[model samples]
Target chain A: MAEKLLNWDEVLIGGTIKDPGNSKQYETGSWRVERPVWNPDTCIQCMFCWVYCPDSAIKVDENGKMAGIDYTFCKGCGICVEQCPSKPKSLKMILESQAKGKTEEELRKEVFSSEK
Target chain B: MGKKVALTGNEAAAHAIRQINPDVIAAFPITPSTPIPQTVAQFIADGEMDTELVTVESEHSAMSACIGAAAAGGRVMTATSANGYALMWEMLYIASGMRLPIVMAVVARALSSPLNIHGDHSDIMGGRDTGWIQLISENSQEAYDNIIQAVKIAENKNVMTPALVAQDGFNTSHTIEIWELEEDKKVKEFIGEYQPLYPMLNTDEPVTHGAWAPPNWYFEHKMNQLRGLLDAKDVVEKVGKEFGDVFGRHYGLYETYKLDDAEYVIVAAGSVCGTTKDVIDTLRENGVKAGLLKIRLFRPFPYKELADTLQSAKAIAVLDRVSPAGAQGGPLFTEIRSALYDTQTRAPIVNYTYGLGGRDTQPRHINSVFETLKRIVETGKVEKQFDCLNLRGEWR
Candidate 1:
């Protein structure tokens, strides 16, 4: 009976993992985003990149050149890359990886510890 | 002291309902709002909330049961979202017309087509003309407190209209947060025992309810409903003040964030207001002079307070999540424009339709909206209507 109860616990917790290709959880990545890249060569420094970044991902350095995105906060909507007014285009975006494997608690800790 | 726990918006709503100790809770399971009933059922089973949890098959039946329970002199509550709320359309109007004072939590979700289960104002906006008092909440904590306050406001003698407490479906409903749960004793003390004016199921004084009315008296009945809704404004403010005094959390009909000396202001409702506040902070830091006006009580439409608050701005951007079909503008924009029409002190108002069908409305989109508003103010060029931060070429 004890062994049966333990088996029941295992089934409730771990036995639900199915093949990723065939699972309904495949639909979980609907909110995924691609990472953005900046090209300072064609940059006009109009602050459009800074203004359009949804996640505050883009940063300006002390000298005011376009510092690369901080991937932690960037949801990669590519608004900065899409809205860049430079003819050659100062910013571009590409599909990267899904943001996973972090619990809410871990994210909160990371957010609080960042100022230090 | 009661224990504090990290609760989702749905859980917080369920916890608040438990605190109210409603005699009847009739609800159906619907996405973004299903967890509320489920959690409330668990509370019932755990003996924490001594109430009847009636499981109904459809949203229509759930609301019907609520009306029945309320008419029978039982304090009743229910919740639904999006498509489920759409299903309860007829009963929603009936509940208001009957002056049932039934309190419902509507977790606002997008209506169907592509079949999205995310958050939007489509559900609540669709029911805007149903004559129900609508209150929008920005976060889980607000969702919890608003439910308790809704019961008080709805059941007040001056206003016996049914109230719909709306929160963002998935964004606020499912997101977890630490909320201060009110003690049951205090809530019971604040919202006293439920009494019915004419309880249908009363054995000593039984009454026939929901009877048909002729045109002669039909208009009078509707006038009563209108009077009740208008009277709700005072009850809502009074109850909110009392609840705040007891719980240390005060709420107003609308809240202005950094609006003092602001050149441009964004008027928003529901959970997006939180994101709007963040963007307003960022814009103020950069000297953009943007501010936010969050509408809490949307029904009987707080026109005086809104006009007084927003009359000083150079330009106002009214962000609406729901669009009125075949109308000249979004629902909120039309109302705001009309509210400020007669006043000499008013600004050029712009309308922006965003986050329709649960499209993710991030802070950046809001910031871009402020940028657009600034341009409108600077150039003095009035754009008829703007769709902010939408995927390019998708509209065609």
Candidate 2:
């Protein structure tokens, strides 16, 4: 998004995308109507949501542990939520309006802290 | 100079395609143009050319396959006519928009309604707005020469737009004429190699084609496309001159016969230009200062050059082989009128919609057009702004 928009002469001819993996700049997360909030308290790191996420939005750390979700590219399709196997469900989809104005830490604390 | 050989327009197109021997050709047979792919297939069978022929089920798939091959960085081509051309209408814009530099031969024919298949401009006229550079041929010789020139014009680094070389259906496609057929080696050397702009198959430096362009970028992309299309005028002239330099046949944006000092002139395209030329010759023998302006390039329509060439004529008539549909005048007519609108040419211009649905236009019909032009010049008025020629029933 920091890259300046190109003029007609400056752009590549034929609408060809010369920059590979440039979709990372597109921020498809803005299309989401609902946000998936993740809870580490549920304690199961089966990585089912990671395997099922169509957008590959599920973030994994160096030890291969599920860290959290990357919202920049997530379309909130909820496939990850559907794929969650934990009984208390470590992953849950909430209305974007419900999650708005709250950080991931705040939303996770509010949704999972009381259950714990 | 090339050797003289006899061929029909379709055969000439096929021979030119064989000479080019492109990397890929995807086509589905239709009337008039069916022989083009068929001849190319025969050439492949005989090993005369090593081009890959992708025989698709329909025109849509034919064009789709052509696009795929072209995007994959291969020199590509195809042929179709009438409804088959109508079928490929959607992909036409995509081919040009993507700047693929594909070439096609269209054996121009009439579109259907009462179900007729014969020579007419209805099909090519319908596609005038599709953004592909258009070349209309007067006979088998121009058909052969134009096809060879088209490859260079389309694949020019500056103008990577798809191009279509058109000749009249039964009139030119089926009729035989002697034309200069260049040696294959010379023809190949003339077209040279096609360097694709952004080939999708370059694995080392991969690229994505046909990506979705949102509002923010769509306008810029379209403007970029227009840049290429408009820039084609210079490339077309440059390539034409080069082709003439290499071979003996020279071409230009348009060809004019006795246009310099003529007071009454007729502007037209396609095989009809030949007949019009004969009529002009006869009028000249009778001491009438009549001439003809035959359009070779229909797209990127050399409006300024045309208006300049036609500025001195006292009266002008535009002969269009297609119906106006609902417009007040035919496509070529309106374009010519518009071109002269800003010029000092005060000539009274008129439109003639003729030869629709394969209706044969005789010399008498063309002679009548000139007579009308002469009358308009003599009387200082246009009796009919738009009229039909050689129609069986009176067209008011």
Candidate 3:
């Protein structure tokens, strides 16, 4: 969501941000030219992507198993794909336009059909 | 009433600093201003003042440390001159932009290429656009008084802008003059306590200062800072008046000497104004209606008040102590001309570049300027709109 812009008088003096930990409010996904797609069917959850992601955009389930990638804060740096240790990589870097509006199963089929 | 004492300009500044006893002072020593920090350090060493003294390695680090300390909710100050001031050029903007309200005493000196260490306006004039309120002092007494008033002015909630009180290097900084030194208790009471706004040290209410403001926010923050600075003209007057009410030495946006019904006037600042006043007195005794408009609050330039004050003069000569550096005229010349632009004052204004690199300006030179103003008034024409005063071998 776009934050409301403040006029000169209403803005905080000296660019002071009163709210701490407010970087969460700024989404970095819009800056991404490439997106990271994940595959959970590799049957290994080394959590290496979670550990390597610079933006902390990786998500995990309650049982401490890798759930998926959180695209909202991902800047598409592809550090996770580079660090993926699986023989058939569970993460792949693809154009953001190619992944847009596509379901995960359809994307998995389209991206992995030519992989094997 | 304050007690009378003899002290140099640098000592006056140090005395004021000791009285204020700010929370922290980070400074790197430079010429003409070195004695200020030196004296303050002695005060601290002798247990006369308990302010934290941070002796930084360079002017850049000095200003950086000052900024850090000020953001941590401490009343901070420092002093520098010439190259040391030039070194802190970048941080000067940061201190004001963050609304740190750090007060500094600037013993104005020449910025060197040929390495002259004498007094001039090059240093302070270089900082005119750095968003700090500039209070120029005519002597050690004014320097002492301005430093005290600068604290209240900069720290005022309506202003929250850093201020630099400048006195001419060597000319005032080294000259001993008899002036009244107010009691420390009165000065402290006048400045009051420091109630910092949004201090970063307050863990209960964490605040981020100097935060990144991208394109969507940078303009507003800059405008806000400007508003605070522009609003400081009033705060300066108020504080100066309050200081006078308590201490008996009243100050204003600018000082006027025999300006009423004057046909000729000289607009100037710093210690040179003292010489000009002497010339004005001499000219007045000779049946010349000569006056002086001595600038005190330089930044926020007080365009309206200055214009109003200068409206009655028949002719005016503005003396700038720094090089124009390729500009049409010096900074003070440009500002005064612009200030008179919108007013009904059609007085013939002239610009003179003088005292550069600490060249001595004599009473005869000032008398020559007034004589030229008198000539302009009589003839209704100015032969040289821009000229150098007392230059060798004639400068047209």
Candidate 4:
């Protein structure tokens, strides 16, 4: 379980960081207005999104294979989509509202089917 | 008793530094204050001291270096004046915000617009809200003494805030004075080894300093910093009394001359208080109840003590040696008025801006202020409020 955010009095004096790199506990991906959808079939295992993402939102397996986007902390900046470097664009941006009511499987199938 | 010697304000401060022999000093050279770092460097060369002096390219870097060294748990210090101080503006907050107990010697000088390089309060007053303890001195002796005491005050566990000791730009910084120097062993005993609390370099403790805080934690950290500053008032007095016990020279938030049973008084700070005191002596001999209050600490202003001292006076004139610049009054006047608001004795106070850009202020100029205060008391009304002294022009 993630630790709750500490209020003013509970925090250390002089803003001294009691636990370094606690930014991981703060899930900022919910602030997204738009998110990039990736299609693994056409991705060619190029690792472009993983390299271009400002946030480490692109997921990679233990074997270093590109998996998918980690929406928990993505922030939906769409930097990977802008720098995909693929014909027909392996990565695409969709309004967060459009993807809201759809399941992850349905959204992935729909993103790939639309490109075809 | 300590040895007696004649040295300029800059040299006196350097002699204090030579005795303390701190771990590190990061400084840049600036006019009127350059001699301090220069003399310290000479001491280091002669093996008189063993401080690691980082000669930076600018005042900003100088302060930056001090912050870095201090955060790593070293006793740090530096010196600058005027424009050099303005350059260190941003880092001043960082140092204090990080709660590093760094000390600085700022030989006060005028801030520039038309380009003047002389003594004034502009440099120090400009940084009033930067969260540093400000100690102003009237002469070379006070300057030396204040710097020595500043070390203990800043390092106090309850009040670990950065401090700056200031002296008059040319009047005190350049002029030679007969100053008593304390024995080195006695001085070091008074300020023992500095054990920084939770320094970054403490490997076993595993501590962190100066991390970014979100809105949830920002307010409380700031309040804690303020608490530390407010708590310094007690520590300042305690250390001052202890210093007097060891060296035989006492200090407080301010020094008042002939204020007892006085009907009219002038409240001012810095070396100008000397001239005001001289005029007060003459005024008293001529049957005038004139007195002067010299401010020693500008930060955490001694509000209660000041109000109690000035409450019974019939009228007051606060002399500021800087431009008002569209404020209700000069900085000193604003603080005085605020401090006196809660007191029952409401002395009709007035402000007089004087000696800007290093103009000479004579005894007659100060006597005129006392005369104006005398008139206000007799008339029971403040007819004229804002005025200037020593300016070349006709007065109404």
Candidate 5:
């Protein structure tokens, strides 16, 4: 994001679009201090995570099976972890600080082990 | 020609709504102010008025619907009381931030906590900084008149901000009073049809409202809003003059009674002003230089005008119907004292919270406040500053 200078009046009434579904541009994921990691192996096909995520972060396949979290807008609220309904939680929250410079595949295996 | 009629404050305000025949009225039932929307609903049911009444689930939705309707280029109105008004806290800012010309009738009631359903200033006083023009009425007639004028004030090209006409809860809401109501045709003519600057559906010209103002832009919008409110002061006076010219009743930001040469004074708002005036007459008969300052327009508060009026009095007792909780004084007292700081008035000011939860403040209570002012004038010092009037506590 490039920082641009704006005048006082322009700043006060900044970019308020009247159009609906404007939140797509907002990217609330920037507010997340924690990230969700999903273990698809132990994960049951039950879509409870999809049903309970406040932001609808848990993505599902066309057949209604669990896919993964949409981290762009997920906000990392952890509702999916709470509603997972598995003994050892299939979904978990990991510190965002540990997620830096790591690929999605690397972070999942690092913090959450399925063998437990 | 106007006809003399007997009506309660809420009933009279509903009559004003009928005359306006707004495009939308979104409201939920709440104590005291319930009658306002209730009567308006009855009118719509009876086919006396044609308004799309949105019977919302709660006060929050009521304001939310009003905002949508107003933003879509429709004249909008609503009414609520203590908790109902409290519920609309966030929406209130949105309505004003978008500069929607929505008019609301607020039957001022005490907020709940051990829950009492009577008149008090806690409701409207709590929303003082919500950026809506506030008009306080002493009786049914003023409530009727102010609602009609609020339409013009809120819709003024220079102002386009929402407004609320407030009256005491049961004290004014349910109490019957004789008032001369103007002809519907005349009232309708006074408040002309609303011409929305940019309606939402104006396809040729697109407009946006309720956008998030970032730090750079939010401060400017707030400053512009402040300028709009400050400009509303002029628009309020102009509309008041126009209403007086048509209806034969004049109003100003604040009304002063015998304040010119007053040695002792009392300042208050709403229905209590009527009682204070009666006490002032009696005090004057006995050679007490007591006067009363009744606040009518509370928002864009007439700081300069009020400070000028209180300058003549040697001492002033600011009567607040709502508790200050843990402040130096009540809300009104703090404003008055602060306004006088740079002014020529060096009079000792006292603060007293009175009439919480529909507790009746009679003329005697008002007379005692004047007496306290006189004593403070003689001794030149306040006695146990900031006390509650007529409370049952031994310390009081």
Candidate 6:
């Protein structure tokens, strides 16, 4: 007996069984993770996370301790998490939910208050 | 009688162009945007559109041809996406700088590598720094109408900068929708004929175009370009009002949905905003005080309007489709922050990254974003950054 072969064209275009993950299904650059988080316990202080972070979100303290990731500049790629060599992995990916909420009016007040 | 026609946003744009009856159509095919020129060519071949369809070798040449045709006092149009947009970068600046009223359809596509051709804001986001007037369309209908309005807005004596009407590729560009096609005579009356400021091909009025400016006068020439773009804000408002009066469809620089008495909001552009609106409606039904801010005009960014609209919210989530690799922020996020800098309106505006490289952004995901915004408003702390929605990990 011959084994059955799956036709990609039929699967993709025939619409019989649609792969939602199909590359042609959507436009490019639609899924972007913006920031990467770091954990001190799993960090070896190897600095790979700092070196690999495209946005330079990873910072090292004066004492050489891996300070913290700056959410402002981070694009959440989890590259630092992927690059961490520690056994438990010191770096992690944090979703956009981790930041604080500041209303535009609140921000404006802060700006004016600071200026005063 | 209004007849419904199922067409992709690109096809709808092509249909709209057919009604416009432009003298010249120059373009280079690029993913998600290729269908536009292809459909336009079909229209031309079928004699539906009496126009010179020039297929250029590159996106750069496409705009160059558009400039040439428009300068020669011909109504011109073109389309490009993603890397093609990046390639046309210098010309984008030149088109606006020269104050040539060229109308371009920019099918929003992601910038390259791990190269993808789906939909994303990277292309138009990259062009934001250019002086062109940018309009983001949420659906096929807006894509059709804005391209028509783009011609009017750009050609207006008060606003001579080229215009970029942007639509998400694959998402909006390829998605089928039933849309109403405006009457040709109505569109003609609405847009009017192209009247050239300086017809380069004219023998009677010999004049030099794109001439090199000496250092002594270079600043003045640049200043004129800046002044024209600044003047365009009023022109955009006026044209938008006129268009609405004629077509019964009105648009503002930015549109607010469900914002009345809302404590939290989500701001975004393109088709995703439609999803956000649905989510906002769901949230409202559930008694969540949430709203949506849809950004339509991206270039002149409508800074004052954005600051005012978002002022009352306790928290706002600013969603961007493009990630700035080295900047630690999405380009639009940065711009929004800067726009709010001096205003008395401050909202803890959280930056959410989603729908990059053509990722699916569903209504449920948008609902979750509003949920997150509500949580941020209540708790006073946000994770700062969040990926609104994403696909399950694939076994590659």
Instruction: Output the chain A TM-score of model 6.
Output: 0.50
Over the stretch B1-396, how does candidate 1's per-residue lDDT look in tens digits? 445679899988988888887999999999989998888899899999888989999999999999889878899999999999999999999898878889899999989877989888888988998889999999989998899999999988778889999999878898888878877898888889878777767666545667644354456566667877888898888888998898888988888899888888999898899899998888888988888889999997989888888877898989888865667677888898888986876577887788877788888889878887888888988765656456456332
lDDT of 6 by residue, B74-189 (tens): 88888899999999999887787677888889999888888999999988988887889999999999999899888898888767788989999998999999887778789888
The segments of candidate 5 whose C-alpha lies over 4 angstroms from its true place after superposition are: A1-6, A10-116
What's the best-to-worst order under lDDT?
Answer: 3, 2, 5, 4, 1, 6
Write down the lDDT that model 3 would get. 0.93
Tens digits of per-residue lDDT, candidate 4, B1-396, equal 698999999999999999889899999999789999999999999999999999999999999999989988999999999999999999999888888889999999898887988888888989988889999999999999999999999999878899999998888899899999999899899889999887788877766777776676677778788877877788888888899999999988788899978889899988899899999999889998898888888887888888788966899999888888889789999999998999898889999898887888889999899989988988888987788998878534
Model 2 spans > 4 angstroms off: A36-54, A61-68, A78-94, A101-116
**i-RMS, each model, one decimal:** 27.2, 0.7, 0.6, 2.3, 4.1, 26.2
Candidate 2 is scored at a TM of 0.92
Off by over 4 Å in 3: A33-70, A76-116
Candidate 2 Cα deviation (angstroms), residue B208: 2.1
Estimate, for each residue in B1-396, the C-alpha lDDT of model 2 and write its tens digit. Answer: 578887888999999999999999999999989999999999999999999999899999999999999999999999999999999999999998899999999999999987878989998999998889999999999999889999998998888999999999989999999988989999999899888877888898899999999988899999899889889899989988998888867888999999999988999999889898898899999999999999999998999999999988988999999999999798999998998889886889999998888888889999999999989988888878998999878778
Could you say which candidate leads in lDDT? 3
Q: Give the C-alpha miss distance for residue A44 in model 2, angstroms.
A: 9.6
lDDT of 6 at A97: 43
lDDT for residue B35 in candidate 2, whole number 0-100: 94
lDDT of candidate 6 vs native? Answer: 0.77
- lDDT of candidate 3 over B1-396, digit per residue (tens): 589999999999999999999999999999989999999999999999999999999999999999999999999999999999999999999999999999999999998888989999999999899999999999999999999999999999989999999999999999999999999899899999999999999999999888888998999999999999999999999988888889888999999999988889999999999999998888889999999999999998999899999988999999999998888799999999998999997899999999988899999999999989989988999999999987997885
Summing lDDT over every window of 10 consecutive residues in candidate 1 chain B, give the lowest-scoring window: B387-396
C-alpha RMSD of candidate 3: 3.2
Full ranking by TM-score? 2, 3, 4, 5, 1, 6
Task: For each candidate in turn, give its C-alpha RMSD to the true structure in angstroms.
Answer: 28.3, 2.8, 3.2, 3.2, 5.0, 25.8
Candidate 2 chain A, run of 10 with poorest lDDT: A107-116
DockQ of each: 0.00, 0.72, 0.72, 0.44, 0.21, 0.01
Candidate 1 Cα misplacement greater than 4 A, ranges:
A1-116, B1-4, B394-396
Per-residue CA lDDT of model 5 for A1-116, tens digit only, reads 33455554444321335455555666778889998898887887788988888886778888888899888889988888888888777888898998888988898788675455
Q: Could you give candidate 5's per-residue lDDT for residues B138-212 as a string of tens digits?
A: 999999999999999999988889999999998899999999888989999999989987678776666677776
Output the better candidate (5/6) by lDDT: 5
